[model samples]
Target: MEFIYSHNLTVDGREILLHIWDVPNSQEQAEDGSSEEKRIQWADSFVLVYSICDRASFNILPLKIQFIKAAKEGQSQEKVPIVIVGNKRDLHHQRVVSSEEGRLLALSLDCGFYEVSAAEAYHGALMVFHGLAKLIPDTKLALKKGTGIRGIVKTMSAVFARKRTDSL
Candidate 1:
């Protein structure tokens, strides 16, 4: 099953509205516009979650991250805010993927990491969303600055370029 949630928060003294898409890992697509490609396009940021108790789920994280990265090939990978989450933290006794492993993977991928249990405590889940929410605005601000710098460079280049003769 898939779930969607809306969150309202203030970041940098400005109100932001976020639509969180809790897309479950599945090969099947329903009639709705929930296909992987469409979902990837719809997302401004991503929180990819895997079950800590399931090794198979842990194994798929790299592939899933790569898919999102590829789908956003036009943007620099670092600009995309992706959080790696290992869910079912309360199932530590049954865990096949260690917190250390999850942490290392997130470090290597340059992503924020969290281990939370949706079935256990709501605080952990809230922290994950809030952390990512903060990151989204920072990423957007950086992109805007980069674009602004490029625009300035383009304008300067046009000014310095040889002028065309106005002969009709």
Candidate 2:
């Protein structure tokens, strides 16, 4: 089964909805009509993950990264940010992917790198989400700063525009 976790985050007075979906391993089938390859290209940002204890899992990441770049061809690569995370640090004794290897990969991609264990490192887990949040621009603040009732109307317009496009 496909696993999805949804959470609403209030950061800097703005409410951001984050949809965290785990990409299922099977490439042959999907519950929905669309393929995972098709859905991935539509994402605004990516949090590509791998288990530090599983070297094979870590090895596949390069192919995934390459696919993301190729899928986003012609668009400014910077616009589509990525955050590489090495999880299962709780089992560091069994870790197969070195911290240096993860850092080097992140540097190569020009994206942020974070090592956190969801089971143990509480602060580090939050930092990963916070780090990803920093990548997204706060567009609402710009709209909310305008003077008078006109500002409210402009903000409403923006909200509706976003909703309309989202429904499609």
Cα lDDT, all candidates: 0.73, 0.68
Q: What is the lDDT of residue 53 in candidate 2?
A: 96
Clashes of each: 0, 0
lDDT of 1 by residue, 47-150 (tens): 88899999888888888788778877566655678999999999889999999999999998878999999998788988987788778856454443333333
RMSD in Å for all candidates: 12.1, 7.5
State the lDDT of candidate 2 residue by residue for 1-168, as single tens digits.
555555566666766665565666454233443355455644556787889998877787777778777676456545556889999988989999999999999898777899989888578867877788778666622432333444333433453343332221
**Candidate 2: worst 10 consecutive residues by lDDT?**
159-168
Clashing residue pairs in candidate 2 (N, C-alpha, C atoms within 3 angstroms)? none
C-alpha lDDT of candidate 2 relative to the true structure? 0.68
Please tell me which predicted candidate would have the highest lDDT against the true structure. 1
